[model samples]
Target: MEIILVPAFADNYLYVLRDPASGKVAAVDPGDAAPLMAELERRGWGLDLILLTHHHNDHTGGVAALVERYAPLVVGAGHDSHRLPPLGRAVADGDRVAFGGTSAEVIATPGHTLGHIAYWFAQDEALFCADTLFALGCGRLFEGTPGQMWESLLRLRALPDATRVCCAHEYTLSNARFAVTVDPDNAALRARAEEIAARRARHEPTVPTLLGVEKATNPFLRADDPGVAAAVGLVGSSPDRVFAELRARKDRF
Candidate 1:
């Protein structure tokens, strides 16, 4: 499987997943059709499927246009049918959908949106997690509570350490800054912050981050850690409470 990152409006990222063996391709959250269509034409690839993680405009804005152009099978959360574009296959948690020679396990990750979902291609060791997860942070709880978001994050935390996280935006640099402010004593986070600065300076992407790296450095995923809990003034609190405090502080930051 080959993954192509297509930058969309501002920091949004649209992805193209291609199966080299079958030459079949799928678009994941196309924010715009022009760039994606151009990329497909450049690579001489035909779109076969459209996978949506959530109903956010930045994620699904180009769906109608692409559907008209490629006539690909659209797949999205059945629970969010009213909000999503027409879905050929409306899936829920644990549903496995085949693409080319492999299949992706659908994980219902509801936090960014009530019907948000992620695609885990185990064979490819890739997690196409839209706004639910980010490079150095997690998504804002716009439609869900802090508890729901925290639980959703815990689910993602259980994935293999080496799994590559394909998040949907370029928010790493700012997230890193916020992370260092909250976890100032964390050497790993400090190192990562510096690296993020350098990468952004070069106009390079810091995505597709290793889950292990996030586990060690991301404060949002480390709410259970004593250091992180104390840093956020939730020393004796439960992981959920710590996470809530962290999220609140991030909202103000």
Candidate 2:
């Protein structure tokens, strides 16, 4: 399986997942259909599936067009039927959908939206986490409370450390800036920020970061770090409060 990241509108990403054996592709959260259509045409592969993580316009707006052009199967939230603009299958958490002769497990992670889900390809160790997890920061609390978001992140953290996280947006640089503010003494983050900046300077994509590396360098994953707790001034009793304080500081930082 090859994961192709198509940088779409603004910071959004539409990922094209390919299975070499079948010569078929599946895309996650296609904001618009033209670019993905062109790529599929270039690769001489037919789109076999459309996996929607949520009902946000940016994530599902292109569903109708793609369905018209390629007639791919659409999978999405069961609670999001009306707004999905012609969904083929209303899926819920734990639903497994097959694509290009393989399968992706649907992980119900509701924080960015009430019915948000992330697709995990355990075989490939890849996750198309639309807006639930970012490079350094998590998605905003548009539909759920901070605590709910916290719980969702914890679930994600439980995945294997080798998992290659394929988040939906390119907010790494800006997120790194705030991460530094949360833990000014973090040498690891500073080095990583520089590396990420250099990668951006060369017009490269800083994706597929391992979960273990994020645990070491990303403040959003290290709310219990001494430096992070000190920087945020959280003298709490539980991990949740420390996480809560870090999130609040990030919101205003």
Candidate 3:
């Protein structure tokens, strides 16, 4: 399995998952269709599926166009049908989607949006986590509460440490800065911050971050850590409260 990142409209990203042996491809959150179409044409690959993680325009805007062009099978969360592009298969948690000889398990992640879901390809150790988890940060609480997002993060964190997290936007540098503000004492975070700065300086993308690295450096995921709790003046607080406080600070940051 090969994953190709397609940058679109400002910081958003659309991913193409390809099966090298079969030349079949699947698109994940294609916010724009032109780039994806161009790439597919360039590679001489046929689109077999379109996987949607949420109903947000930036994530599903290109669905209609792609469908018109390729007539691919579309899959999305059932509860979000009103907002999402027409789905051939409406899925919920525990549902599996197979394409190009690879399969992904749907994970209900409802913080960014109530019906948001993530696609976890266990065999590839890759997660198409739309806007739920970012590098050193998590998505804004638009529709769900901080507790729901926290639970979702915990579920994702439980995956293998080496799992590659493919987030939908390029928010790593700003997120790293905010993380340092709250986790100033973490040497690991400081080092990661520097690395992020250097990568941005070179105009590089800091995505597909390893889950282990996020566990160590992402403040949102470290709500239970002593340093993070103390920094947010929530010592002895539950992880949910700590997470809420951190998210609130980030909203204002």
Candidate 4:
């Protein structure tokens, strides 16, 4: 499976997962059709499916347009069917769907939204985590509880070390800034922030970082570290409290 990242609205990303051998491609979160359609036309790839992780406008806004043009099958979280654009398959956790030759495992990751889900393909070492997990930070809990978000994050963090994290937005630079503040003595975070800044200066992307690397630098995934525990006042707090405090600190940051 070849993963193609397409930048969409502001900082959002639209992913195209393709089976080059079979000449079939599936788009994940086509927020708008203009840019994605052009990209498809340029590559001469046929879009066969739409994999939506949530109901947010920036993630599902162009679903109707794309479906109208390509008539691809739309897949969305079963719990968010009411909100998601006309969907063909409503999946839940543990459900598996096939793309030309690749398979995507639906992971129920609710935090950014109650019904938010992520697509994982171990064979390709990639994940289409729409707004749930980022480079150095995690998404804000819009509707779910802190405990729910924490557990959800833990689930993703438990994935294999080689998993390539392809998040939904260009938040690496901003997240690195906040992460350094959250853990000032983290030398790795310091170095990465500068590198991410340079990438932004060159107008380059800073994504597809390995999950193992995020474990070393991302504050949201370091809730057990002494620095992160202290920063979030989690020394004697429950996971829910820690998550809430950590989120609050990021909000202020």
Please report the candidate that would top lDDT against the real structure. 3
Residue 245 of model 4: what lDDT? 80
Clashing pairs in 3: none
Give a tens-digit lDDT track for model 3, residues 1-253. Answer: 8999999999998999987777778999998998999999998887989999998888988899999989999999998988999899999999999876779999999999999999999999999999999999999999999999999999999999999999999999999989999999999999999999999999999998999999999999999898899999989999999999999999999
Q: Return the TM-score for each candidate structure.
A: 0.99, 0.94, 0.98, 0.97
Least lDDT summed over 10 consecutive residues: which range in candidate 4?
Answer: 231-240
Rank the models by TM-score, top first: 1, 3, 4, 2
Off by over 4 Å in 2: none
The digit string of per-residue lDDT tens for model 4 on 1-253 reads: 8888899878988888888777788999988888899999998876899999998899888889888889999999887899989779889999998987788899999888999999999888998898899988899888988788888899999999899999989989989888887788888889989999999999999987889989899988877677777765568666567667888888787
**lDDT tens string, model 2, 165-223?**
99988888888888888878878889999998998889788786788778878777776
In model 1, the runs with Cα more than 4 Å from the true position are none
Off by over 4 Å in 3: none
Candidate 4 or 2, higher TM-score: 4
Order of all candidates by lDDT, from best down to worst?
A: 3, 1, 4, 2
Give the per-residue lDDT digits (tens) of candidate 1, residues 88-163.
9999999998999988999988888889999999999999999998998999988988888888899899999989
